[model samples]
Target: MGIFKIEGGKQLKGQIQPQGAKNEALQILCAVLLTPEKVTIHNIPDIIDVNKLIDLLGNLGVTVEKLASGSYTFQAKTVNLQYLESEAFKQDGRGLRGSIMIVGPLLARFGKGYIPKPGGDKIGRRRLDTHFEGFIKLGATFRYNREDYFYGVEATQLQGTNMLLDEASVTGTANIVMAAVLAKGTTTIYNAACEPYLQQLCNMLNRMGAKIKGIGSNLLTIEGVTSLQGTVHTMLPDMIEIGSWIGLAAMTKSELTITNVNWEYLGQIPNVFRKLGITVEKRGDDIFIPAHKNGYEIQNYIDGSVLTISDAPWPGFTPDLLSIILVVATQARGSVLIHQKMFESRLFFVDKLIDMGAKIILCDPHRAVVIGHDFKSQLKATTMTSPDIRAGVSLLIAALSAKGTSTIHNIEQIDRGYEHIDMRLKAIGAQIERV
Candidate 1:
């Protein structure tokens, strides 16, 4: 585990570039297994989860070549199917949740797929029923080994069919889409997750000769192709990271400019922050946030009701940013409710904020009511542990705004999502050290 020692009460002023989307990279990297030819991908984020996936791919006998810092060519000409049954592979596969996405491409192209139980943050129950059920709907046989705790899917030839997912799961949609792209016939998926990551995966598959429509909508139609050819794909900037920077700037009263953000793809993120009375400016493709000198205030609803910020699907505010929103609301004027509808335990981190002198009431597992201090009271720094990736960054932001130096342990959680976070913040005049 790593620790970040941060000295708060410093104003940051500079420009920072968001890294490649981590979610997009996970799906894109898995898609490389669909073709035998070389698939070149650019703008890949260098994070722990992604690196673990890359290592797993190499272990599966895919030829990986580094073209540049954030560019790679993957050729899956000779995959070691036998390796999937190995104990070492099972242990490595369970290290990250995104590793489960590899099953779809493997099942589609090779007629069989296997994965160990996937592991990720303990925020809530992230079920895999959607992914497996979608595969089963596509004429695949699903079996789970209880003793070994492994999942395997097999089909001599997958036949496409219509699937209405129980929920619009992001990874589930990506997995099903990858499987359906190489099935025998057309596949229609309603209530599909159409986030930017999924859209990029569909576009990349289309370039590889897969027939897919509905680029940025919930309804997706894909016609199975016999085979896919290699293609080059570049990922969009990380919108979550962009949102994190916005919240950090506002909390620390910093003048920060986030560069080259895909403003079009960042749906409702800026507006969510603005609802909390944060200053967000759009200068072409960049976002410039001026320092909040007099302290920011929460905006009331049109009916003069307390504002409520909740998580929803794409084009809606992301659940990942709700933690940042909660932390930022601590210094705002007036009160607001933070509702984390998707994950139950994500709001528990607010207890740490309460320890730092923030007035937050933990209503339940999924909701919290925050009464903003509005800069009249400054949070005193303390020792804390990062619960998850998003919450870790939110805590880092809180420590940046606190009065004294704070130590955050288990920052490996933060590194899993954000690439070189301490280094990036340090370049922007932040007082942070990794120990």
Candidate 2:
């Protein structure tokens, strides 16, 4: 059942919980390799990409045990360094994009790390240069095998130094931070990504006895430590998923509650949805999206110009949720421009929405104009393919609000990010089934 068969025009109700963050789980899971002691993590999302990383850790001889649902304990006391070069390791690493993150932890403690080209959503060109460059500044020798698309880094010992990242990449910063936690000197990372995910990693490392300062800022200073201890960490709710639920509720004219949304960490998400005139009421830690018996409206700029939304680093709108925002706008009351600054191919799925009667003009690969239908006419159901994780969920949201049954192929992309989405939606009155 790799496809989702959704019966549209259903009014969904009841509450849903956003799973642990997919991004944060990737970084935090890789960080278990930094220590040999037992580390327990709670709120772990049961998703494909994260499960792949956990299985990869098992292959590397990190003893992982399931303590309970959404909880696990891991110990890397006897890591199998030889597995790094095995054919089986190559295949496992190739299938998971999060596998690249294990390099820093392995290189730090074992003095060597090797990885085949990692895989994930084929959204666009994602460079590994920043990660390697950071490792190089930490005094690790880097080598690349072009024929095999393999990368390796080795050092007798890593000596940390000052470096400015070419781009504020979240994964790159996470990799560099993990490596620097075990280096011999001070490491100053400027222009580092300070997303909530990165901050969570730093906090977890500090709990494990690493010296990290300037969390939630672009400049991070890491005082190297000889070794780290084990600690427990609980992840924040997935803000992207919360935003998607907001979009889903608005599109379907349904009243829904999203619990324990971690409001402060949500940053610009609720506000951005408000810009589209979706009422997001906060009750305790939960988000209540009222049924839009009357359609929502898009707010104009202060000067009465069209509202423009764009993606940036942390404290800015996340690129991950722009697709949901775009899909929600198809039924709002005004026009808006969505500028997808980071990824070149992310906005390509708008054509699928267009096929379902959305009045979206693809301005380019990175920009689009969404003219809201104001619920005057419903989207016509259609079959579509999921291109990437975010786009896949966005399409699913569109299908759930369309006029008839809709079929979405390549739901594996969705499964990689959202945990038990079909089952959870079914619990909340969504007519979605795995077929």
Candidate 3:
């Protein structure tokens, strides 16, 4: 129920480091349940989602120890599967969609899994059908009783088989991977989500003695093993956070040096930003943004016309960032059409942008065309509630660069993803007060 009051139109300066990837860290935390041995994860972001996941693990009796800042050691040596039915367990699991990943691990190790509908951002119709389909293909029988979804598998006798996922649901792909790692026979998962998060999961599983081929590609072949040993792993820097920071700097005309950014995983981000005329300089592992008084311009198409930035699956501009890109497009000089194909309601927040005097056309539920009026940013402070994590941050960015004071309530949604976002923004000269 907290709110952020921000005085905008301030150019953020100085250096900031994005904490670890939220999606990757949550998936990795569930991987800890795959083994009873100790697994130490470094660079873990202290965020709501991650904490909720940790709470989920604790409910299952996993021993978690917070070491230093951004580091934690987990020992799930004795997992009590019975706690899955607890009201507290169900409430926390339902709060996060990542809790579904635990279903596969629990079913694989304990032969049964039960969890209510998982919840997270209410962007659109996020289906668990794909996850259930993949698990069923792996020889598990699913049952739905009123609100509880249960999976009962004779896991000891379960045999791995080829699974072609209907869609590349990120968590669904990861769920099957965790379930297949300890199955009896070989498991082949085609059309898999090979994002950096999944790659880290594979790497951690490999260290724990799971045979997985195709680290960073769509098709993955997993050879089942009898048991997995504990291993230590560190999560990669959050590319989405880095991209968000890049967008932030470009929008505010601020010079910021983003440190510890893993340049290797940043596929297509540089090109995507280039389309918006945002220039980035690479200084070793860090990216430097030079301040610009004149707003950035959107690169035109081959016909010297306005361009469009749309979201696609992996190896493309992520849908999760389409909201941020839309907000960034408002400050650019030229026009660009932003598309949010994955979620039906994601483009709804453009009304807030339009209220800030941005020139935007809501083409449909999933697409919005933004024309940069380059309005003098005469933003009057207004009270708005955050809708989702990405959209919430986008609004925050717009608020920081706008004039006057703006109050954003329901910051817990924003806290779910970005780590210490307000504190980090304040480091770069953003005037944000939490109430």
Where does candidate 1 have its weakest 10-residue lDDT segment? 343-352
Off by over 4 Å in 3: 147-156, 375-380
Kindly report which residue pairs in candidate 2 clash with one another.
Answer: none
Expressed as tens digits, the lDDT of each residue in 1-435 for candidate 2 is 499999999999999999999999999999999999999999999999999999999999999999999999999999999999999999999998889999999999999999999999887889999999999989999999999888999999999899999999999999999999999989999999999889999999999999999999999999999999999999999999999999999999999999999898999999999999999999999999999999999999999999999999998999999999999999999999999999999999999999999999998999999999999989999999999899999999999999899999999999999999999999989999898
Model 3: which ten-residue window has the lowest total lDDT? 147-156
Off by over 4 Å in 2: none
Task: Give each model a TM-score.
Answer: 0.99, 0.99, 0.97
Can you list the residue pairs that collide in candidate 3? Answer: none
Tens-digit lDDT track of model 3 for 1-435 = 999999988888999998999989878999998888999999999999999899889878999998999888999899887687677777777788788888878877777777788889989898888877877888887787663654334344457899888888788889889988988889999989988889999999999999999888889999989889899999999888898998889877899999989888888887888888888888999999888677788889999877988887788778888888898888887899887888899888888878877788998998788887454554445668899999999988888778889999899999999988988899879999989
lDDT of each: 0.95, 0.95, 0.85
Q: How far off is residue 255 in model 2, in Å?
A: 0.7
What overall lDDT, based on C-alpha atoms, would model 1 receive against the true structure? 0.95
lDDT of 1 by residue, 1-118 (tens): 8899999989999999999999899999999999999999999999999999999999999999999999999999999999999999899999899999999999999999999999
Q: After TM-score superposition, what is the CA distance of residue 23 in candidate 3 from its true location, in Å?
A: 0.5
